[model samples]
Target: MIRFEGIHKSYPVHGREVVALHPLDLTIQAGEVFGIVGHSGAGKSTLLRLINGLETPSGGTLTVDGQALGTLDGDGLRRLRRRVGMIFQHFNLLSARTVLDNIAFPLRLAGVSKAQARARAQDLLVRVGLEAHRDKYPAQLSGGQKQRVGVARALATEPKILLCDEATSALDPQTTASVLQLLDGINRELGLTIVLITHEMDVVRRVCDRVAVLDAGHLVESGPVAEVFLHPQHPTTRRFVAESEAIDEGALQEDIAHVAGRLLRLTFTGEDTWQPLLGRVARETGIDYTILAGRIDRIKRLPYGQLTLAVTGAQSDEALRRFAQAGVHVEELSR
Candidate 1:
């Protein structure tokens, strides 16, 4: 587990201290995949480094597994880093080293005997499904395979935590999905605590249990991925959510300008998604509704749907009431 209490970071820029991260109070639960999402310069990458002590904080404290990072000496910090592994955006691998030796590098650095390290690395190769590529250099492998090697190397130490700094950002969409699935498997099997920073909301939706939205160094929103994705509160959070859903607010508004009736956005999750709520409500309330835009999707296995609809006639108000009574979140939109 990791906890940050009023933690903030700064650096000197032209002899003036510029804040890179705002005061943060967050707790990443044990064995859960936590994600920090933000655009470039939003401080998410800085937050990830802060977790493993790659970046020192200017104020407050960060504790990982009961060890206060600020209190650690150089040797203490090195020891603690062995318990936390990190993977990078570019698949940081020694170009000259074969996949086998690259994976064994971390273990060797930890004072593991060459033979033992090679054996452990060989086993990780199998675990990450890169056994066939063990003898190949980084240059010979595909992007996905290269990232797998990076993952294998990160796991060489068998750390309790894994820090992924845009580990899949460089990969294509399909490759990203495969790599994320691998991470999900690692979390489920080994129960490793994963802290990843990414600009892609799909990454969080696919694997993260909880997520925090950062903007201009501020923690704009933090909560279960499903909640934040469904009902984003902050402006930055909303933009991220909208971008993920590919919803162009301006375009949608223009498209609906001529539409009649009261516009409402309905959100439903889990079993509610399977129920014939729309048909049932329409029948019961005698309300005619038109779905303007919507989609059914999953948020880390939780089924959910958000439908932008138009409702007309007298029963529209009662229909909205029934939707609320059935636990569907409704938000009114302009005509």
Candidate 2:
């Protein structure tokens, strides 16, 4: 488990200290995919660096798997880092090394014999589906293939925690999905704790079990992905969600300005998301409904749908109640 107790960070810039992160408390349970999201310079990279002792906290304490980061010495920090692996946004492969050598570098550094290191590297190479390119150099591979090598190298040490510093931001959308799938599979199969930082909520929705939203060096919001994505509490989080869903709230409101009846945003989850709940409710309540906008998506493994609708007739309230009874979350937007 990882825990932060009033953690904060600052940097010295030409005779003055500049705060990079505000004090915040957060805990990530073991074997879960935790995501930290923010735009550029929101201290996300700083926070992730603190986990592996690459950056020191200016105040407070950070504990990873029971080791206090602030108290660790050079050797102690090295040992702690061995238990935590990291993947960079750019596939930081050694230009001079083959894929297999890149994967074996850490083991070699740890004094493993050349034969043992290469054998372990071979296993990781196959695990990441890069055995065919094990002898190839980074320059010879595509962007996605280079990242696969990075992932394999990070896992070669059998670390308990994996830190991904915007690991997919540099890849195309299709490649991003494939890398995310690989990360998800690794988390489930090896029970490794994965913490990734990204600016995209869609990335979090696809793989993160829980997420924290950072804005201008502050932790603006944090929760389970389903909760944060469906019902954002903070403005920063809501904007992120809107961007992820490609929603223009003002435009949507303008489009519905002249529409009559009650405006409601209905949220459905689990089996309810797949069921024809809206049609059935309209039929049962004898109300007319028009869907203004809607989307069906998944958060991690849970399916969900959100619909904005205008409902009319005397039984509209009854329809709302029926929706609630059917395990749907009903938010009355306007009436």
Candidate 3:
């Protein structure tokens, strides 16, 4: 587990102290895929770097797996790094080395013999499905293949925590999905605690169990992915979700301006998403509804559906009550 108690960071820029992170408290539970999401310069990278002692906090305490970071000496920090592996957005492979050699580099640094390091590298190459590219150099491989090699190299140290610093931002959408699937598989199989930082909410929706939203160095919001994604409370978070879903709230409101009925936004999750409750309720209560906008998608492993509807008839209030009773989240929207 990783715990941050009023942790904050600052840097000396142009002869003055500049705050990069505000004092905040957060906890990332063990074996869960946690995401730190924000726009550029929002301190996402700063927070991730603090977990492995790459950046020391200016205030408060940071503990990883019960070990305090501030007390660690040079050797202790080295030991901590051995247990925390990091992959970069740009594949930071050794230019002159083969994929096999690159993966074995970390082990060699840790005093493992050449034969033993290569042997471990061989196992990682197979795990990342890069066995065929083992002898190839970074320049000779495709972007996805290079990242696979990066994953293998980061795993070479057998770290308990994997830090992905925008690991998929450099890839195409198809390749991004492929790499995310690989990360998800690794998490499930090895129970590794993965913390990834990205600007994309779609990435969080696909893999993160929980997420923290950062804006202007402040920790604005944090919660389970399903909860935060579906119902955002902060402006920064809402903007990210809107961008991810390609939603134009102003346009949507304008589109519904002329519609005549009570506006409602209904949210359904899990098995409720599969239920035909809308039609059944309409029939029973004689309420008519027109879907103004709707979306059905999966957040991590849970399937969810959200719809904006123009509901009418004298039974509208009863229909809303029935929806709430059936475990559906009903929010009234205004024009």
Q: Which candidate tops lDDT? A: 3
lDDT for position 273 in model 2: 87
Poorest stretch of ten by lDDT in candidate 3: 251-260
- The candidate 1 region of ten consecutive residues with least summed lDDT is 251-260
TM agreement with the true structure for every prediction: 0.98, 0.98, 0.98
Clashes of each: 0, 0, 0
In model 2, which regions exceed 4 Å deviation? none
lDDT of 3: 0.95
lDDT of 2 by residue, 219-250 (tens): 99998999999999999999999999999988
Please give, for residues 1-335, the per-residue lDDT of candidate 3 as tens digits: 89999999999999999999999999999999999999999999999999999899999999998899999999999999999999999999999999999999999999999999999999999999989888988999989999999998999999999999999999999999999999999999999999999999999999999999999899999999999999999999999999998989888888798788999999999999999999999999999988978899999889999999999999999999999999999999877
Superposed by TM-score, candidate 1 places the C-alpha of residue 22 at a distance from the truth, in angstroms, of 1.4
The lDDT of each candidate is 0.93, 0.93, 0.95
Instruction: Give residue 279's error in model 3 in angstroms.
Output: 1.1
lDDT (Cα) of model 2: 0.93
Which is better, 1 or 3, measured by lDDT?
Answer: 3
Residue pairs with backbone overlap in model 3: none
**Cα lDDT tens digits for candidate 1, 92-138:** 89999999999999899889999999999999999999999899999
